[model samples]
Target: MPDEPKRIVEAFSQELHAAYHKAGVRSYEAFAARSTKINRAMHSDTGKHTFVSRSAAYKTLTGKRERLPTWDQVAQFVRVFRAEAADRGIAPDSVGTMEQWKAKYEAASARFWAAKKAAASRIPAMAAAVPAAFSDGPQTWWRAYADVVPAWSERYLNHEPLSHRITSYEPVYVPGLLQTPEYAAAVIRLGHGDEPEERIARRVELRMLRQRHLERVGERPCMWAIINEGALRDGPVGGETMRAQIRHLRSLGRHVQVQVIPAGHPAHDATDGPITLLRFPSSQFQDLVFLEHADSALYPSSEEDLAHYLHAVQKLGLAALMPDPSRTLLRRLEAEI
Candidate 1:
């Protein structure tokens, strides 16, 4: 079976192309000429005729244009195709009767207009809702909530939900997606010491909400986190909070694949700071590398920079303990705590 069309326009184009070929019309230029002649005869009484240009016909037939042709244009093309097919002893039904073509055109036209309107309205709505800090650029919707989520992480948040797999290397703290509520609150409080308690609480709430992407019923992204053993041993939160955090990591065994790099391991790549690599399901979007810093974040756009981070993360994965052994290490740490 043929794959489904990715967009409504493509589906509508396929229908037109199939009908055009069924009528034995080969050249778009020839079809345009025929359509023009028929349109002239149909509107001759009014002395105002519609001519179909080759470029317009080509776009409509090939689905290269953003918007569908007007209804009159579509009707003219149908009449032209039917007339040509009848000349060759072809039945109108074989080339798609007017009623059949009309139904297809109306359905596709309605969907196209609805989608266009929604797209037109979304820009203003998004612009109005976004804060001034994020209004300067596109895809900065996450900036409105910058107080709760770090403003520097706007780009990362945009891609997180769309990623099919996420690989992260953290040398100082647990990856946010794997962190427990207590661990997250402690980390937030320590990082933003000047912030009020209520603000800190909201930050923790945002972190918990972000973690939900991993808990989706289906199509949840695969999470592979490699944490330095020191992060687990020398964490900000300790005592029962630390122990519960360790326990939480263990319980996530079924959902997350966790690895730990032992202390005293040889110096290696990704030692500078945390690295998060996001891979999308579709090839249309390039894989992204997110490097988080104290007050800012960087998304390396150059191919060379992306390649460097990709290699570093791969090396970190190899140096870290394997999944089963990593869980064993987590168990020992929980007991020690």
Candidate 2:
């Protein structure tokens, strides 16, 4: 029988493939040559040389084989890629050290097996794409997914340097980038009521910092946000707070193209859920979809998952009020508030 697809392995494989591409190691011959050089520098293993054939390297990237690549094989790829990145003066923390690469490899391996186990116990298709981590599901599953990912804030917001495009659908509230300080504070306070005031303040500060990406000097991220009308209407965060937030959204119209999904839009794609799709300029780094939950965020790796969310965004865009009309709606909402 053929092996089932594992999103964890596929995701890691893409990252590894991207590392090689960024290093300008295109052909299998060149990759193997670099591997040999790195192996010689690290050790004097005359008998056991680092050798990965063209077919094997291709299989690793394509995720065609049943077994995951060995750690030593992954290490060789990482070292060569890191050295190339250094030559170009690029220092990404994701692949900065051997230990980091190893940790990621191990985590991905563990997740693959876990998915397989879940498939065996439940249904075979459960292992198809690792089930969405933050989809509407049990809290235990969500927590388990969150525990596996770290520095999520960094992963979500630090795409500033990548020159990517961001399209977000916000059904409940205004996006962080267009939120006013007072509005942000009120929302945070309500959500994290038990947290200390100082901690909440720090959290708010970090969120504001992430918003800086929108104001970058050259080639800032192209942002398109579609907000639901309910978010504007159902607000008890004090009239002044909501009013200011609406005005802030209007001001952000200068940079971000904001749209309003008027209340009772018959074609509301967000009725199911919301998603943020990120597209990169480089072909090496695949498009990403970010699903934000109450306490955790999800990065879906499957192409099917990505397509579903991207299609939702397109439908929302079609149903949304025009940009000029969206600003007009915001102004009208502000006056009512």
Query: lDDT scores for all predictions?
Result: 0.72, 0.66
What lDDT score is found at residue 249 in candidate 2?
A: 83
lDDT (Cα) of model 2? 0.66
lDDT of 2 by residue, 89-200 (tens): 7774445478888888878767665565454344223124322432223333123234323454334544433435789898667887778778888878766779888767
lDDT of 1 by residue, 152-265 (tens): 577678768777889999976899998898889888876687988888888887788788889888887899899988678646565578789888989884658999987646
Q: Listing every candidate in turn, what is its Cα RMSD in Å to the true structure after a full C-alpha superposition? A: 25.2, 24.0
Q: Lowest summed lDDT over 10 consecutive residues: which window, candidate 2?
A: 133-142
Predicted model with the maximum lDDT: 1
Off by over 4 Å in 2: 1-154, 160-163, 268-270
TM-score, structure 2 vs. true: 0.55
